[model samples]
Target: MTSTPSSTHFLTIKNTFISTKNHIHTSLNTPLHAPNSPIWTASEIAESVHGKLLKWGPPGTICTDTRALQPNTNQWFFAITGQHFDAHDFISPQLYGKGCVGVIGNRVCEGWDNGFVQVEGNGNVNTVDSLINMASYARNKRFNGVLVGVTGSVGKSTTKSMIALALESLGVNVFKSYGNWNNRVGVALSLIGMDRNVDIAVLEMGMSGKGEILELARMVRPEIRVVLNVGASHLENLGSLEEVAMAKSEIFREAKLGDICVFNADDPLVSTLPVPHGVRKVFFGRRMGCDVRLVAAETADGGLGVRVVLEKEKEMVKFVIPSPGLHLALDACAAAAVATLFGLSLAQVGKSFSKFVPVHMRSELQVARNGIKIVNDAYNANPLSTRAAIDLLQSIACDGNRVAILGDMLELGSIEIESHEKILSHCCDSNIDLVGLAGNRFLIAAKNMNLNRVKNIVHANDAKILAQKIVKRLKFNDVVLVKGSRAMQMEKVVDAIKAMSIHIPP
Candidate 1:
C-alpha cells in the first residue's frame, strides 16, 4: 500500500522548495513571466485548488484574460464565468497551442493535451469558486509578508495607492491591488498575485452590501486595517449610514491581537467604532486626538500644501502633496500614519508625499489646448466625494470662469433623490459660474437651486448633451470640474471639452 504524505510533510516541502525560488527580480523591462522567476508546479497548484491535473508542464504565470495571452511564456489560464459572460466560450485549441502550461476549469478545451486541470462542480462548473479557491490556496502557500486592508465609502483606491507608495519609499517590496479592483474577485486576485518575495501587500476591499468586506477580510487576513471613512456610499442597498459603518467595520473581523487598525478621527462615524480587543488602533485626520493630524491645508505651487502633526513623534511636518484638493491632503495624513506603524519616520513619510500621484480621473488636473484647466474627478462618486470635489473646484485659483459638470450619484437606494438635492446646497455655496447637471436625480436638484446663487445652471439627460453645453460656454483659462458616479460616465464631459479646445502651443 502506498502511504499518503502528511500535512506537515506537504508544508515542509512547500516551505523548503518554494523558498529557494521565491526571489523575483522585477524591473521596468522585466516581463511578468521573466526567466528565473518562481512559479507553482502542476502538482502544487492542483493540491492547492483540490483539482486533478491531467497534463504537466513547466511552471509559469497565471492569467484570466485570454486577450492578454503572450506567446513563448508559460501561462496557466483559468476559465472564469460571470453572470452574462462565460470564459469557457472563448477557450479554444488555438489558446492551448500558444505554449500554455495548462488550463483550469470545469470542462476541458477540445484537442488539448494532458495540460488541463479539471475541477468538479455541482451540475455545472463554478469557475469563480474554483478561481477563489485557487487564489486562497496560493496565498496560503506563498504569502508570508505583512498585508494591509483598506476600505471605505470613498478614498479606498486613493488610500490604497498612497499606502503602497509610502511603503515602497521605505524600500519594502510592495504589491497593491491594481487600479480600483476592490471587489471580492479583485481582492482574491490581488492576494494570489503576491509571492514570498514581497515584503508587504496592500489590498483594497470594496462592497455594495453588508458581509462583502467580511468575506474579503477572511481571504486577505490583513495585519493592518485602514478604514478611511463610512459615508453614503451603497446607502441604497445598506439602507442607512449606521449600516454602512457596520459593513465597513467588517474589515476588522479577522484581525487578531497585535494587529493595527487605522481610523479617520475626523469622521464621527468612523472614530466612534470600537476596535477589536487586543488590536492596536491609530487615528488620522484633522481632529486633535488623532495620531496623525492635518493641521492646515492650502493650495501651493499648483498642488496642495499640507501641515501635519504626528502625535507619536511629537513633531510637526509640512509637505506638498503632488495632487490637488484638501481631501487628498487628509489622505496623505492617513497614509503617513500607516507608514509610521511600519517603522518609517516622520521625515521619511513627508519626503514620500512628493512622490504621490493621484489615480486617473480622481481629481487629476489636465490643461486643454485652449488653456482651459479641467479637473477630472469622474471616476466614481458618492455624496461625500462629490462634495469634496466641489470644494476643491472652489479652492483653486481660476483666471477665467469656474464651471462644474455634475452627474447623478448612483446606488443611494431610497435616499437617491434626497442625496441629489443635497448637492444643490454645495453648488450654491461654491460660487461656481456655471453648473451643468446630468441624470434624473440631478435634474431635480437643479430645480431646487436658486438661479441667483449659481450664475447659470443647465440640466441635460445624458453626459453627451451635458458636455456639449459646457464646451460651448467654456472660456479661456476656465477651470472646469467634472464629477459623478461610475455609472454616470462623467468622463465623457471632460473628453468632449478637450476635443473642442484648440491644442495650445507646446
Candidate 2:
C-alpha cells in the first residue's frame, strides 16, 4: 500500500488477555487507545449517535471489521448488518478475547457482556446510519481546518493526492482520503480518523449515481470543492452526459459563502455548468479566461512539461510533472489552482510537482527484464481515460512495437458497444502497431471495425487467455499498455507478461 509522507504513531491502550496456559497472569496487556483522551469519548459518542449504552467506559478506537483490529486497542465494533452477511454473527467470546472494547448494533449478542452500544432501530435500523451520524458530528465538532472535497468522473484520486502534496510542500499539516476511499462509508471513516492538528483536509468524493455526491458533500461540507471533469463514467446509472454533470455539480450544493469551487474550463460540458450564488468559481484548463490556464504541454524527460498561466497572477510558470500522461499534466494544473488559493506561490506549486508520485496502477510505468516498457493503468477505465492512456503510449519513445491491450469499460449503459468501438477507432488512428482486446464488449466492437482500416486486432474471451496469447507474441523492447475497468482485471495481463519474461533469456 502507498502511504503519504508522514510519521504515523499508533496509540496503545492496555487490556488483559489470558494465555493458553491456565495459570492466571495478573496483567495480559493488549493494544488499545483511550478514545476520550484526545479523539473521542463514550458520552460524546452516546450523545451523537442517540444510542443507549448497555455498558459504558472510556471510549476507544472505532472499527468495522475484526480482522483490522490492532492487538491491544480497545475497538468499538459496529455490527453493520448487510444483505449478504450480518456482523452480528461474528460477535463472540473470541472477539472479546481479542480486546474488543464494545459492539454497536441493532440487536444484543446472546453471549457477549463486555460492552454494548445499542442503536435505536425500529425493527430495521441500520448501524451504518448511526456510524455516519457519529462521523459527521465528530467532523463538525473536532476540527476547524480548511476542507477540500474532490470529485469527477476520472482523476479524482490523482488530483486529490497532488493537492495534498502541494499543501504539504507549503508546510501545511494535511490529511487526505486514503487510496480510493471516496464513497459514503469511506468518507465517514476518513473524517472520523481526522486529526485535530492538521491545517487542511482533502477528501475524494466518488459516486455511481445521482444524489450520492450530495450526501458526501453534506458530510464533509468542504470549503473548497473541486470538480475535475465530467466524462462517460457511471453513464449506466446516470443515463447521459448531462445527468453525469448534474451528479458532479452536487459538490457545490453545500458550499457556503466565500467557498471556492474549482472546475475544468477546457471541458465543454463541465465549463457550462451553473455555479450557485455566493461561491467563488475558479476554472482550470487550456482555455483562455480560465483562472489557471495551460499555456503549453509537451513531453519532457519521459514525463510532461506544462507551462501554465495563472490568470490571477497574470504570469506564466512552467512545471515538470513526473507522470507521463496529458491527463496527469492537466490534473497537476488543477492541483496548482487549488494550492494558489491556500497562499502558495506558483513557484512553490511548481517545485512541489517534483515530489508527486503517480498512484499505483494508474498510468504507472514499469520496464520488464526483457527491456519492454509497460504502462500499468489497469485500475479503472472509461472512454476518456482509455484515450488518454493510448495518447501516453503514443508519446513514449519505444524501441519496438507499440501495443494496446484494452478490455471492456463497464457501466456505459446503452452505449457500451458504441464506446468500445470508438476506442478501437482511436487505437487505429494512433501509432499503435497491434491491439489486443479482452471482454465481450470489445469483441463486439472488433466485429464492427473495418479490418482494412485497422489490422492486427486480437480478441480473447478473458484476461487469462488474452495474457497467454499476448505473452507469446511479445518481444524485446515492446511497449505494452494494459488498461480496463475494475471488473476486467487487466493488470493480470501485465503480471502474466512479466512472469513470462522472467523465465526467458533477457
Window of ten residues with lowest summed lDDT in model 1: 1-10
Query: Could you tally the backbone clashes for each prediction?
Result: 3, 7
lDDT assessment of candidate 2: 0.77
Alpha-carbon local distance difference test for all models: 0.76, 0.77
Indicate which candidate wins on lDDT. 2
Q: How far out, in Å, is residue 199 in model 1? A: 0.4
* Candidate 1 colliding pairs, count: 3
lDDT of 2 by residue, 1-506 (tens): 11121111100100011111232111101113223223456776676678888787556777777776666767778788766878877888788766687877776567677777778655668777887887788778887667899999999988988888887755545677777778888888778777666557889999999999999999998878899998998999989999999999998876776677888888877877776775677888877777777777778774433333343446666767776787777898889888877656777887888667778788888878767788899999999999999999998877678999998999999999999988888998895898899899988887776542345777798898999888877877788999999999998998997876434453
Off by over 4 Å in 2: 1-38, 97-99, 303-312, 450-455, 502-506
Per-residue lDDT tens digits for candidate 1, residues 1-506, read 11122234224422442344334333211123333334767777777668887777567767777876787778888788888888878777788556566887777667776467777554457777777787787667788777788998888878878877776655556677777878877777666666558767788899999889998888888878889998888987999999999899998766786677888888888877776776677888877767777787777754333333344447787777766788887788888878766656777777777777778899998988778888999999899999999988888887788898899999998988778877877887778888888898887666655442354887789898888877888877788999998888999998898888554445
